[model samples]
Target chain A: MDAKRLTLFAGHYGSGKTNIALNWAYRLRDEGRAVTVADLDIVNPYFRTKDAEDDLARRGIGLIVSEYANSNVDLPALPSQIYSLVDDRSTYGVLDIGGDDRGALALGRWVPSIIAEDDYDMLFVVNKARPLTRTVEDTLEVYAEVEAACGLPFTGIVNNTNLGPETTAQTVLASMEYAESVARATGLPLKMTCVDKRLINDFAGQVDSLFPLDILELYYMQKEGM
Target chain B: MGEKVLMKGNEAMAEAAILAGCRHYFGYPITPQTEVAAYMAKKMPKIGGTFLQAESEIAAINMVYGVASTGKPAMTSSSSPGISLKAEGISYLAGADLPGLIVNVQRGGPGLGGIQPSQSDYFFATRGPGHGDFHVLVFAPASVQEMADLTGKAFHLAWKYRMPAMLLADGTLGQMMEPVELPEPHDAFGTDNPWATTGTNMEREHNIVNSLYLSPEELERKNIERFERYKQVEAEECLWEEYLMDDAEICVVSYGITARISKNAIAEARKEGIKVGMIRPITLWPFPNKALAAAADKVDSFLSVELNMGQMVEDIKLAIDCKKPVDFCGRVGGMIPTPDEVLDHIRALAEGGR
Candidate 1:
């Protein structure tokens, strides 16, 4: 499991990008690498990486989110701390880009610096279970929109197809062809398939580059019986 | 029915409204519930439906009124402040006996409150949204699945009763994601609307839709007639869910997200040897009084859990006729009462501390 200096997750809204970014940051930290997560999500009012701020801090991972992330203000204000991602080359940066083209627009300011580094991996996360990105054509449409908005092309495709808390091993298995089609259509490498940690045991030898996710959003609500 | 998919409560309701034959949607965006308007804006045009982002919440609801008057399924959604702006239009829908789906994905507020989940609008919704004497059929969904299911139900019931129906959701429910099996697309717009203001072909008299009556006698008669329909609704349309109510000495009353939190509290209380249960009102307007009244006979006491400052406590007292001690446990101004907080309340009640 090799990670670039910077790994960015961008996709359509509700495509599980925030959750994947958090998981990737944790993986980087566990591998004894200095990690910092920059949440450039101004599009979504709920389910930002900042929701896991305390957990990230405890794990020795630095987090940079909107100044008004969970303040209920709904202002599209990104933190100035995001510049540290590109300026500070000593730490591994994981970015949780906002949902859709509107969300990805926040990435425009950092694109030049990130491109100068030439080592960032911007992965387009796809979830077939979402209503909007249900087809290959629709997924590609979102991919193009996100890329156009952020001025960054995706170098990899991550199959994050899920049904939230109801995701099953079979659901992941069934979405393989769809994920492969997306990867093939975009001519990008199939970087990984994200499976919920609860179901990781079910995909022992069947899948490659299987990334186990400790779904933080689901954990927050379901743990509280909400 | 469709395969299970992950959807936010706001998006699920928008999709469910479309499935229920709501071809017309008019709304102004507000936080925590903006996904509803966004989803409609994207899907409605593609489906040949009308999705208009009106100039204001007031204008959006009036657009709904216009479409609903023509006997088509129309809807509008907003958060707390936005819903307040549409109050006059909702009252007009009720007064004119027009069927329209009005979704209030509530946020904390008296005036432009913060954009966080709050059930503080219980009184605003149940008592009547506007000045006139009217009750909009209100459905509070606790889960994302119920968010989609009850949306279809709200449309069906609104048309059946010839009045406005509101899907009362809080910000937490509106934003949270869960697996939901969406309802099959259906023509919930009833075929028989003799009072609809569809242009009469001169074969029949023009159907007039109006709430204004100059004559006092005519206005009184119209009010009485609407109340008669409401009586029928109260009797046959009241919806509620009773969880572990049998043989329980302590009853917990809640709805929407608070109800989900209470269930967990009830489970913990039960494990601690407290005989506790829950009665979740699915229909807030109809109030589920009969169920609460019956629960009063079996339970020693009741606890009303809410996200507001005990707004639903008054309704619970009225429902039970003050038969037993009713305690209130709640958080206000967008604060959610955690399961442990609710459990502690239940434990105190069980110990006769409150």
Candidate 2:
């Protein structure tokens, strides 16, 4: 397995969080890395990391760390795989956090601890198409809220702007530019750009490497009929 | 199978039961849970389902008792206070060993607790829910999909074990709207129910589904048998999540919404060079205490954060047996502690070397 980066997808509600987060996880899992995902969405009740469990399980991606992972009571926390994999040096884990600034704060407890020594990447996922986030100021306000809540500087930004199936390459590039500007201002890296499953080619001109939509699990489901 | 649609927790759960062949629903309208009754009212007749908005929580629960006795899938839901009123019925369901789906889109409570989401019912749900030596299979959902997914599972578990099963959700999970890919509707259940109060004519002898066994020996036998089932549930069904605790020096323990916040806290703490992690429990009743206990063994400290004041904190202490300093993080009533607030607690815990 390839050595993996500890990538975190952080954002607000309806900000294409689970879509982008799940996409990144799918990318890493398919590239021959021992990648696992944990759903920490105790904030909202929609498409979350755990919603993709049965599908991810087919890709050999560990979706739950709780013995009661399938049950309700959404106590969002780190999974055992995180601790077991922390020292293993072979496993790469992705934690899909909840949406909302409140969710950003929820993430504070884990950030400082995961990278106590090793370097890891925390990507503040941004979607301009979302109503609450229409401009750089709005995104920055979110950034500040999350940073303050989490008690740490956001290290990177992932431009994940897509209006679902209607999104085009132009809008995707524009969003990438916006995220890069924020990254430059904050001194954090402009991490991967999150593109929709149908808009993967739109990033060819602007992004060096844009994470694809859940192509990993999609490919598996198609091939194995799982 | 029907076409796939995007649904919310409250909407999806109501539909899931109908898909599970449960045509009967009884409930009282309450915030966060009003959608369940509304959805049923809108769709029950379309697909030949029974929907009722009872006069009170008591009436709704009794309605459930009537329908559940018929051996078909039956259910009811309410907010915290309404759920409290249904405690009498919940106890009866347990005593009768009758399978039912009782949902609580928990709102904050002591009396009419605020209409916001809260998990303070950890005690009410895990304990008998009312006055009785009984327990219910409680599933706490962190996301909407689980709200739908677990509803189906709750029905199956309820019938499989012949017990009352509750989906303990909070107001947030109930009201939130996220993209949920609903499963296609399936065939109605064909399995025969052995304990339902169906007529004796042409069928087997009458089966009385009630919790009024007053004989001490009979009560003891029934309670003992129920305990065996609970033990099996504890052994086979306890569920939870652990994050970054393997080499974690400090662990943040939380559930539901709070757990999500704590995760971000861990992410932030890690960036600042602290080895903090998280432990979230999915099953509040059949708690994954063993997993948490194991987590405590590895971490130097544990912080139990909740929307209430130290309710779940006590549970954490019991599981780990004071293996480490267990710090409590909370914003009582209806206040949800921000991730930074939780981080501050963790920072203090780490700085203090707990």
TM-score of the second chain in each model? 0.99, 0.94
- Which portions of model 2 show Cα errors greater than 4 Å? A1-226, B1-5, B187-190
Cα lDDT tens digits for candidate 1, B2-67 = 788889899999999999888899999889899999899879998999989999999999999999
lDDT of each: 0.91, 0.73
lDDT tens per residue, model 2, B132-233:
788888887776667777788888888877778889887667765444545566533446887777778875777887777779899899999999998998
lDDT over C-alpha atoms for residue B306 of model 1: 92
Cα lDDT for residue A166, candidate 1: 76
**Model 1: runs farther than 4 Å from truth?**
A217-219
Q: lDDT tens string, model 2, A129-149?
A: 653465687778777777777
| Residue A29 CA displacement from its true place in model 2, Å | 47
Cα lDDT, model 1, residue A167: 84
Candidate 1 backbone collisions, by pair: none
Candidate 2 at residue B333, lDDT?
Answer: 65
List iRMS for all predictions: 1.0, 11.7
